[model samples]
Target: MYDSLWKALKKLPLLPRRLNYAKAPALRFLDLPEDIVYEIVHHLDIRSLCNLSLTCRQLYLSLLIPHLHQQKLPDPFREIHLNGDNCTAAIPALRLLLYDSPIKAFTWRAGHDPRTLVREVEQLRRLIARMSAIEYLELDFSNNWPANEFRHGHENGYWAWVRLATNLLHVVAQRCRVVVVTNHYQVLVPWVTFIGGVPYNLDPPLLARMCAEWRASAGEAEALGSTKLMKSPSKISLSHPDNAPASATFPQPFPPEKGSTVYATRRLIVNDPGLFQRSLFGEWALDWVSNMPLTHLVIHQGRMRLPLLRQLRLPRLTSLVISHG
Candidate 1:
């Protein structure tokens, strides 16, 4: 009877115990001053920082500080890489980063589908256009083809591929300091120190046209040679010289000669051996080299003829890599 009575008492609601229980204190990261919060954030890696930002609006705004981003994130937080699938998904993150951080270099690796590749390229172009500063941009199409496949023809869709590549290059060159198009490899470093295999099956005619436009525009600027006119920000123009007034001319496709006040340096890499072959090495090849401001040149699976080398105007050429064709 005593045991039953004790059990009945135990089953009764316990107001005293419920009154004694207390809730745990909440973490108040936002309670900290902005400076202190940034200091704490400094120790976080990119992933951690991104997670922290998602916690609340207060943390998001605090992390957007430019100095904090530069100090906490990898130096030159500018270099970004995107694979085919992630390109669309990564845009929101990219825009958030660009809200305070500057993007200097970007690389996009395309997938097999030609339509998707074109869309991704267009998207990348739009993203680049928003940035106030962009130096190096690389569009890699090598992922579309297998490693062993290097032959050029309709079977590989060489013409369509070249046309797209050329168009992309033209768009990138307008904004970026160095534009790199790779056919079958990944280059992690920037253009200044690029080390990799050569690009293949490049269209000579399109290259020739690109070279001709650059040469003609550069020549026109040189002929005008007005230091005051070139320096004036309000009057600066990059139009084709023929389109400009005779009194002023467009700036060179690449920077003008170094040491001069108006000079800016640029680099290019053409890995296409077919364009440099003996039969194809004509005025187009000469024009391409003579106009380019390439500081480093890498040609794979092809020989660099002495005459073509002679035609190069890359006084700034520091590194040259040539592999067996």
Candidate 2:
């Protein structure tokens, strides 16, 4: 009788009890300022940060996109690889990624179209200007210069490349510690050598133009009393002796008297074999390197003769590498 009564009583509600439940609102993670959000995620690893970015679009922009250059991450951030296809489209993102970012290296791979080379270089120049001081910059222009192709319509392309090359070097010398510039093209026609000892695309005229622009800029820097990286009594005079243009006399090599300049660029690399040919600008190249405060120098697939090597007098040069054919 007691068990039956207990069971029956459990099935029946004798009195209704009053209960209270509280419901708090959800936290808005994106409402915080950018700096504060960065602080909160400072301890997060790259994977965790990536996961958090997927939670919302705003978080994706704030966390993942801007933090692409985080030092803790792998080479994707520390080393930026760019080609002709992604150069212009990646500017805005790169601006955010490069600002105050510890990016150490940059590489640009160009295509074979001579017409688009200059325009692409302009875009590249813009991106480089935004980057912080970096360790290495590699510009591979091998495809842009084909020895036997586009012979009739390549002169304008050559000049455009020369001007842009000059400007790019100026920007790089200040921002990069080491730069490797390569333009490897095989000579297809033996008779082409009769023109200038090299192909038409990379002839003495183009080299002279590049050297002249460098001298012009150095002369301007001298006139402005900016002797930081360029100071030589025999440095290209802005005013020619006979009132002729400076470019007229730019073909001549520098005097044997050596002068040095302190530049942020500590190392240089050239990968073109015919670039410093004696018939080309071998002496000019020697004089140029002897003047720079370079700690390291490398010339790959070059024709630097033993006599030319003897002429190299770099007081601060600690390492040298030469690769001949």
For lDDT, the strongest prediction is 2
- Summarize candidate 2's per-residue lDDT along 13-122 as a digit string, tens digits: 77867676677878687777878899988887655676787788778677755564443223445777776565544433454443465356677877555456556777
Global Cα RMSD, each model: 16.0, 16.9
Most accurate candidate by TM-score:
2
lDDT of 1 by residue, 1-325 (tens): 9999999999999775556558888878787787887788778765577677778876666664443334333332556667765565454345555424335556677654443654566566566545554455556655544323333222334224333333344345444445455553222111112123435444445444444444344323322111111221112232434555888744322322233332222545554444444432233344444444556555554433556566556777886655553
**Steric collisions counted per model:** 2, 0
Task: Name model 1 segments beyond 4 Å from true.
Answer: 1-77, 91-104, 144-164, 177-179, 184-265, 274-292, 301-311
Q: CA lDDT of each candidate? A: 0.48, 0.54
What TM-score does each of the candidates earn? Answer: 0.42, 0.51
Angstrom error of the Cα, residue 72, model 2: value is 18
Local error of candidate 1 at residue 151 (angstroms):
13
Which residue pairs in candidate 2 have backbone atoms (N, alpha carbon, C) closer than 3 angstroms, thus clashing? none
Model 2, position 280, has a per-residue lDDT of 25
* Worst window of 10 by summed lDDT in candidate 2: 187-196
